[model samples]
Target: MGMHVNEVCINCDRAVADHTQKYCPNCGQPTPVHRIDWHFLGHELEHSVLHMDRGILYSLKQLMLRPGPLLRDYIEGRRGNQVKPLLLITMMSAAVVLLNRLITGGGFMDEGFSQTEAMGQALPAEALRFIAAYRSVSAWIESHFAAFTLMLLPIEALVFWLVFKRYSRLNYPEWLVVTTLLTVQTFVIWSVLVLVHRWLPQTQVLAGVLGMIYTAASLMQFFQGRPLGSTLWRTILALAIFSLASSAAVVAAVIAVMWIG
Candidate 1:
């Protein structure tokens, strides 16, 4: 038999791969294995790698310059030199998570240790104090993830649609893509929060909600370019519905993670 690489990566990019492999360690960018000295596919594989790398860079550059434009451009004829929208977003999100762990110096799950104490449990003082503290920190992050997502996303979308209503060019789904892009941005923000934690109070909880509002406002203003829309009250109601839907999605994600993984 021969060995091969799989995605549940063992190699520490600090980010955990979602699956396991026999030959390769890091799955985010995995190396192909040649078991029987087969020389074929190298050229094709190399081209694939170069193309993907270029696309990622292009996407990143676009993301930095015009966060609102990247998704729309990708949806247009301009593809291949950019990462697939969903995959790029997900991995970037995961990378931010990985980077956050590096900055924070531990996994968010470790925060679970702290919850035990809050539950009215008593234990030897020295036995697990460190673990408890670690877990507490992680648990706090875990608990806030969905709340953070819900608090900002839909309201921002509503704001976006309203601000650009006059332009009449962008619709809700278009606005939604911009909001979706924030998922990756949300990951990016997490990494920053850790660095901010060292010097200032970390307010992932508060900042996340606020950032959602800020992001929504920025996007709406960008599209609006002239003035705000009239249906402020209606937009607010729509935002509530959208946020509720997002909450349901988050709950589903958590349950799916639990049930499947």
Candidate 2:
């Protein structure tokens, strides 16, 4: 018999012999020997997340090209080839936060502070003092806006779930997935607007209009089989309810902070 050859597993770093073995015994990962060179890196990239199919790029393409059909497929139990909704949203949120920081040196904090200042004038001196003292907290929230956005995912999911419960058979978690994917799309739109804001400083209004239209369209597409008028009205009501709930929560937080201080 020929001499047995042993090779180190790239992932587990354990000795893996048996040339006939296709996977590492310790980690069960594929045993592909990749050389330490640019070509190997390129090969890995082609097979990994940068692959043309079954990767983030693929998911993003599908989302843009056929979000309704893509989401419908995922919800209807055909999720083998798609990226996880939560992962996509989380990645997109991080990308948004990073892009915002790089472009604006701050992510929404300036607007937050402007709003706070406007509100401060209406509040009592004591409340204003409290707001000033908690300015750092606001900054922290702004800096970590991505996390806060994720926190709103459940509320968004609930809005859709409640509105479409009678009209669709999907449950809350499924709605959560839908909301997450839609939010990812919104983040992409927001990123584009941020890039264009330098030339068109007044794009905020346009962004708002586009966001509303996108949400309405996405909701209608999600409930595609439903009547168009019914879907439109439910989408409007859901959006109104979500906005009110969000505003109330923000006001309540501010009041609680002032009361504590």
Candidate 3:
């Protein structure tokens, strides 16, 4: 049978003012109580998990089309329409990891690494050990990509905060939110380019370049009143600092592995 409206809400027993109303005014329960059926269960699951009406897809579209305005909207308290930033990042990271595994059958290491290994044949034993340790570290990173992405957010946010602190009024936590959205955008871009990589293997560098460009564009949009050149320069500076820090960490890890081995 089709849904039938009830004069009183089954959940709260509140008298619904309008017979045409879709939900109870008192408790916000649906006026038309659904029976326990496959249709109902599916609808409930979609509403609870995906919330496709105005959650992930909506946020992603806005981020992709107009990240600066979207970030400004959420930071300024117009957030009801968007999923939580951290949750979005976590979900996107998981999806990217899964997609990469599906496409590559496990981990997709750089093809150039093998060539580098061949060229390093004449190097000293210590240098050879370093190269091997670096490869091992890189493989571990690719396998735990999601965890590494999440771990980088705090430091990335710190870099943004330091670079833009004098110009913007947003605090460290707000910068964290900005970085989370940026990371989500990166993940979305990576997801698309990863599929393209099957046909065009050289697009990996393009993905990195596009991610940086999108990030710079996003900051430009987020700080509209500021001079575009100034925002661009600051963004470049922030990215440079973050890249150096991440590279240092990876090198340290590789060195540690060499010593242990």
> Which has the greatest TM-score?
3
TM, every model: 0.47, 0.79, 0.81
Tell me the tens digit of each residue's lDDT in model 2 across 189-244.
Answer: 77787787678553445665676678778767767887989988887888788878
Q: lDDT of all the models against the reference?
A: 0.53, 0.75, 0.83
Sliding window of 10 residues with minimal summed lDDT for model 2 = 1-10
Q: lDDT, candidate 1, residue 114? A: 45
For all candidates, what are the clash counts?
A: 15, 0, 0
Clashing pairs in 2: none
- How well does candidate 3 match the true structure, expressed as C-alpha RMSD? 4.4
Question: Would you list the rank order by TM-score, best first?
Answer: 3, 2, 1
Sort by lDDT, best first.
3, 2, 1
What are the candidates' C-alpha RMSDs? Answer: 12.8, 4.5, 4.4
The C-alpha local distance difference test score for the whole of candidate 2 amounts to 0.75
lDDT of 3 by residue, 1-261 (tens): 424447678888777777578887778898867678899889766765567546678789899998999999989999887889878898888877777778755554554566667776688888788888988998888878778877888999999999998989999999999999998988898788778767866444666678899999999999989999999999999999998998888899999999899
In candidate 3, position 13 carries an lDDT of: 79
